[model samples]
Target chain A: MSDQEILRTTGLTMRFGGVTAVNNVNFSIDHEGELRCLLGPNGAGKSTFFKCLTGQLVPTEGTITFMGEPIAGMDTHEIVNLGIGIKTQVPNLFNGLSAYDNVRLAAKRKHLKRQAIEKTFDMLSNCGIENLKGSEVGLLSHGQRQLIELAMVLAAEPTLVLLDEPAAGMTGEERDRLAFLVKEVTKTASVIVVEHDMAFIKQIAKNVTVFHRGEIFAEDDVKKIMKNKSVQEIYLGKSADAA
Target chain B: MEKSILKDPGLYVMVSIGLLIMIFLPIMMDMFAIMQITQYVVLSVYALSLAYIWGYGGILSFGQSCFFGLGAYTFAVASINMGSTSLPFILAIIIPALFGVLLGYFMFYGRLSDVYLGVVTLVVTLIFWKLINHTAGPQYAIGDARLGGFNGIPSIPILNMPTANGQMMDPIQMFVTFMAILIMVYVGLRLLIASEFGRVSISIRENEVRSSLLGYDVRRHKVVVFSIGCGIAGMSGAMWATYQTFIDPNAFSLEMSAKALVWVMAGGVGTLAGPIIAVVILQWISLKLGQLNIINNFVLLGLILVPLVLILPKGLLPTVKQWSQDLWTIWKKNKANEGDTIIKESETVNAGRRK
Candidate 1:
């Protein structure tokens, strides 16, 4: 609701039959370029919450507002048109198409014809994926494919980017490059990364939201979150009785 | 943008040669052969309607004949009522397009796709077939034109020049008109596929979820493409009606729908020219088989088709294209004294989904 806020969610919740995937929660991110990380164990509701934001899933109860517009339960295209870039957990790409074409389409959507051509090449190079431009994405390695999707999402020049486990299947060197590319994106857009890699999180994230039992158990500076006793206990799979 | 479609030297040459052949071949053939080619031209348009929707939009319907039959019936009834041949063509195109919009809205908007989409289309065509079959009574008349059920509507008006005082097209004039129409439809589709919207449609076919997340209205695009294809089918149906001077429920038959799928698959699914050429070749084969009478026409056609599909799973045209590309690459490598680099380039040419 505030001018500084790019996105805000009020009492957001998602339930599947008997189980609550994302419990009631209120969350917001600033309009300023910032890299925020969502960290949680396997089923701590981070991905569900991300899906709700991307309009891939309609929450059982909640309201998601982006840039003064209500986007919760809106069509995926409608949500995307509101200046949000979305990437699912896996690489969702046009596998049959060349990588150049994949980025070209995204760039074309957000710019004029001439500018689109320029931006497509620029984004491809910026993401360090210019080499794979002519290759079919389906045949590319997992890390390379992830970077291509990153280039595509960045090509649109969105105000907010929601990436789910972008470095899920990457080597250490690839993760380092991904971290660099993601930081470059944060210079222009607000990025929310849902990831499990603490080392990767330490590299790019400033603010980290640690989710536990379908709720945000801890929210702090990345350095502080790494050392907090309670957060450590939750992350280590230690119960209160054992502690 | 469409004008630039024929700008490619290779494609431009091929299209010009193909058109010239169509124009000249009728001169050498007898009236019977000319009329048969006209029939194939009309069917080419129908097959193209399927090619556009399924090949590009990735929405395969087993009941494209529903639109084809609607156009035929619309032209028949409207021409008979108006007592003029010219205006009914437009109605033929518009009615089926309107129906496409209606049906596409239900299927795409409701997300009823894939196998369900195929079944829904199949059921729709069958419903049309059943509905038209039951219109045997005089009460089924639309104004002056009666639905004669299985017997069909005869004495239908033939096509006339739009502003030539109702002068009907003769055999030669009709042949020329049909050829021109076929060429325009083919070029227009090529233009459409080369545009930004067309590229986006291809991307949607590759991955619907990704296209949507990338800010494309997947359902709306599919609906529009489906409707455009329906309109083309209607135009071809009108052409068929004019040629036969009869309209029947058989226009909506399952066999009519299946032929479109077969022609597209047999020739090639992705190329615009593939389905059109396949329709003509297969129709000719069926005609030849009918004359020989050594085997059932459909069965013999199937016997040939099965082996063709087995040998080249990607379809006739695409495999031929890949083979040509490979040959060209090998020649280039030999001439330039390059080996590994040319081989990689050749693989890129052969395997890349879109040219």
Candidate 2:
């Protein structure tokens, strides 16, 4: 492990009885304030790999080291408290609570009461949803809810941030806003995004890791990967080459 | 963030009004009415215990009465042996709280949740009920306080002033103590709900996985909430014991547990005021039913509850609050539209004058 490396996983494998969702894979991020994108086709083990890192799903075989500590099977809260922030694929917010409360609770977890309030409002305004603070998260549109969850994730002040399918249901405007926020987050913390939208990735990603069939298929600069024959073949279903 | 309760003068003013009523209640009512109301007030405290855990924490423990009975039994036995009220009174809350810690550790730490958690608590209450019932033998006596089994302990010491040889409270004074404590519990719970602990507990209830991923120890928060409920229920149970001067194994019965649930569900699952109102109304109906003998208290309760569940799924208070809010919005819209029409009418008249 290098001094700047924030996380490293060795032989990371996840199996569901007969199915190995994530095969033995070694991965790492070796710089502060880095932004990495994970791209893949469906069933490519991107989400499974993300889950392994967050402790949402323990690996059948692997060792995960983060910030110079072994945290493979630690509780999710423990991992989060160690300065890793996570946002699940779908927005799982407190539906009954106001948007302010949802962000405030997350902010409150890391900061003192006054600072938490300040941070909450600051994050809300950053996400451009300060006007919707009083509205219930459950009643908000998909884009609005996605932005709120991103605000919540940023409120924790994590040194490492993980986001899963952040642009899944977002409009073009919402996607650009999310991309801007992800870039801003990368200015202070290393961010790893798992996304299916290549256009969304192009806006912010410089380095990318492609997953295929439960393994890391390729790791390179996003520009090189975009033009690579195999990578394009994998994405366009192999017939784009013949056509 | 919820503004601290201390900043809310309205709550203080409301409680002050409740205090005034407390002072006047005994003077205005007969002893029989006072006694019944006192019991209802104590039961309200017990109901609040469940409301906090179920409504906010989203832990629906069906065995709340087991802790209530534990508190009652603890008070009875401790007061009998000690021949004083002070130590027993404190123990009434602490013992049940300790039990809560133990039980909560198992349920929350073991990752029991939702229906499974509910069933575990229900089974626990039954275990206590059966265990207490079997202790009819003289061997069941701990020191001087008898287990009394199905008969329960009788002539337990009344609540008293803190002294070496305590002076027992008169009926009116006892009534005041019970009423004051109920108000205090209500205030304390409100403040707690506004605090970090309360908000986090609500978050855990909302989405445990999300809360954990955001860096909260969901299990620990849950255990603290459960224990707090136990302590509150225990305190109320002790007061109930003091009022009756007796307690029996029936305190742990399934009926007692169900009654608290019905009260919380019918009154309002989330608000403290709802359960108190529900308890008073339902208990009053129950008293009336006892006199008429037309229907069993529970039968009438079930009849009322089914509709309450069907019509107002959020419970009575929250539903009523929503209705008022909806009505207010409609009124505001109407007022705004009326002003718009008046402005449009004036503009049309000006245009006609110009023509």
Candidate number achieving the greatest TM-score relative to the actual structure: 1
Q: Judge candidate 2 at residue A13 and give its lDDT.
A: 96
Lowest lDDT sum, 10 consecutive residues, model 1 chain A, at: A234-243
Residue B310, candidate 1: alpha-carbon lDDT: 96
The best candidate by DockQ is 2
Q: Write the per-residue lDDT of candidate 2 for residues A87-132, one digit (tens) a residue.
A: 8888889998899999998888889999999999999999889999
TM-score of 1: 0.90
Put down candidate 2 lDDT per residue, B133-174, tens digits, no spaces. Answer: 989989999999879789888899889866535888878888
C-alpha lDDT score of every prediction, in listed order: 0.87, 0.89
Predicted structure 1: lDDT: 0.87
Residue pairs whose backbone atoms clash in candidate 2: none
DockQ of each: 0.54, 0.68
lDDT of 1 by residue, B81-195 (tens): 9989878999999999999999999999888889999999999999999999989989989999999998889988989987699898888789888888888888788889988
